[model samples]
Target: MVDIRIPRLNTNDASYVLVEWLVDDGATVESGASVATVETSKSLEDLVSEHAGVLSRRLPAGADCRPGQVVAVLTPPSQASPPPVADPGRPEGGGTPEAAPVSPVAMVITAPARALMRQHGIDEQDLAALGRSLIRRSDVEALLAGPPAGVSPLVTPEATPAAREGGHARPAG
Candidate 1:
């Protein structure tokens, strides 16, 4: 009988809540066939069987399964135990850990701020570097509070006539 252990789908921090079992006890399963669905904090993933055999024993659905815990046992047709693969994508003796990929940072900005940022062609990363505590709509407003770095303050439609006609006009070269 092959002891089909619940493979660790992720790092130690990850714990799975067994959602449901797709196959019932004694059900014949093919290699890499999904046997159960598990839910983590981020997503739901299917737990697939690694051996082609009859599922002789299994844990019921809704069980809180941990990494390296045996969730089921498969009785192979010919062999008593399944042969281990040459490279299981793990260390030689198995169970050595590897580093996880880092995810990109995303700042939560308000809808209005998003619109304003798009309108102004402001790079969010550049604004993030401005040492603001929070990237809120008010922060964007504060950035707009000052005149743009190289551009003069925008004149309202009401002030345009006076500003255009008599305001500080550039001297002739």
Candidate 2:
């Protein structure tokens, strides 16, 4: 007899919604066969069977499944019924404590860094090469603190017409 437990896909995920069952109760399922579909906040994933056996019982679809929750029980063909699961709350080995719902803080990279990276087609790895901390706006500003040693600053459209005319009037003596 084997118990199938709902698995946690991510650190911040607390529960999954059972979307559908691919296999029916009492059906003989092969090992590694997808038995059910579960939906987390990020994506939908299929749950696979660990052993080849007859699916004895399955929790109803649309149920909220927590990590380590036994969603189904499988019985070998030779056995009419499998033994009841030892603990419904704990998963196998009983070593991992039940996980509490996790609320992680969202990280927001500063607008300037995001824009600069986008414009330059620079990836996170490339930004790291600049020796910047890569955490906040100040880090990005620090990276841009000075221009490249040999390169000179270029004029932009915002330059005044007189400046564009190459300083029409000479400096006062």
Candidate 3:
């Protein structure tokens, strides 16, 4: 099935409105068909079908669409609708639900950190172990690297420069 998504119409708008759909849901149309009308801040443009197939509309006529967001899918004439898959946000590990809050306080995740989390399938439960309300990319990396921050398996106090330089074990009287 080919995904029918809104294209990047302009640089200024972060999202566009799906103004209308020219074709009905599950309608069979030829390639290059104008399937929907999308509205940007500046213009209303046609959304086209990439292939000749049966349209399966995912979003209604009036919906907000980000660039590359799949608003519809086109199943080839011979193929049946694709089987539903589990939500990506939900972990396959049979663990906590995706929306479970890490803490009572709001957690602020940096954009890069969020991207890394998605890429690595690291959810809030994994992040909650971090005990930090603010999550950054380095924190995620440290978690991915097999140890939490500041607690390295390799380095000990004896490995420190001060310890190796013959510093007193206790303060001088």
Per-residue CA lDDT of model 1 for 1-173, tens digit only, reads 76776666777435566666678777788999998776554446788887788776566666677877788888776744453345556555565444478765445454456566655445565466555423555676666566567865443323333344555322211
For lDDT, the strongest prediction is: 3
Q: Write the per-residue lDDT of candidate 2 for residues 1-173, one digit (tens) a residue.
A: 89999888877779877767789888889999999877666667899998998986557766778989999988888985653455645656675555679864233343445555444333454345444332344554444444466764222222323445564322222
**Residue pairs in steric clash, candidate 2?**
none
CA lDDT, every prediction?
Answer: 0.62, 0.64, 0.72
Per-model TM-score versus the true fold? 0.42, 0.46, 0.46
Q: Which stretches of candidate 2 lie over 4 Å from their true place?
A: 81-173
Worst 10 residues of 2 by lDDT: 153-162
Error of 3 at 57 (Å): 0.5
Residue 28 of model 3, lDDT score = 91
User: Which ranges of candidate 1 are over 4 A from the true structure?
Assistant: 12-14, 78-173
Question: In candidate 1, where is summed lDDT lowest over 10 consecutive residues?
Answer: 154-163
